[model samples]
Target: MDHKRDKEAVLHLYNKILPPLAEKIYQNLTEVTPLFDDFHLEKVVDTWTKDRNTTSEKEISLENGNVQQMGLRLRLNGFQAAGAQTFDLSKDLVFLLEYSTYTVGPDKNTRWLEKPYLESWTSKEMEETASRWCEEIIDEITQKLQTL
Candidate 1:
């Protein structure tokens, strides 16, 4: 698991796995009608981490009036280690979501409200965690949207 191999795997996950899954999620959300009329799936380009390594991210968002109603982002971070004659590499997938509403205060100040959720999973648990978390978030959002 050299850097090249590690990068390749990351690319495979970013390019091969996420796009179709995001599309499926988008399609499902669309079926829910007005709640998800503004929902969109976006491919975030490569981003540099604090250590200067590259990471990939994707986002799904629903917007209302000039504000973000709900959003979810998935980011992948990779790492590598070298032994005497061996190499080990791994990655973590981080999922983030913001569930929020807006409020106008008595003083006439507008405030954007939010409840944030974050979860991280290792490469070995990527598939299970991704599927489970995405479905859970979608269900929760759908329920919440129906009330709005």
Candidate 2:
């Protein structure tokens, strides 16, 4: 299998999906309960989760990579229905994309933020992408709001 393709597919998945998904969330929320706009769509709580397992149990080598994942963090709080007298809703909209493995030592070359990546993800690159995605999602949300 082509690991390089795997890496590119990962990038595409995040870049193309997150912004629209966020937009949909806001749209759906507004459709269901617009009065709680003051509460919904507050922030994206960034969090990373790790799976303590190797890719293959048969390949129990020290160099084998462990499963690490970056999850989408969106939380809504203080939401209530139009007729609710003493009720609030808080929800976590987390999207776990893919579980990645980081192999030790030199491996194939991958491009991230116009730089090379071999073993693990690039922090700066991922940060930049997240910033861009935030802007995009916000832009979409604003557009949808203006229409409403």
Clashing residue pairs for model 1: none
- Residue-level lDDT of model 2, residues 1-148, one tens digit each, is 3243133544443454445545555554454444444444432322233334433443321122221222244443343444443233343333332343221111123212321223334454444544554454455444545554
lDDT of 1: 0.32
Full-model lDDT for every candidate: 0.32, 0.38
Candidate 2 worst ten-residue window by lDDT: 103-112
The candidate that wins on TM-score is: 2
TM-score of each: 0.36, 0.38
Candidate 1 error regions (>4 Å): 1-5, 52-131, 142-148
lDDT of 2 at 20: 52
The reply for model 2, stretches above 4 Å from the true place, is: 1-10, 40-47, 54-74, 80-83, 97-148
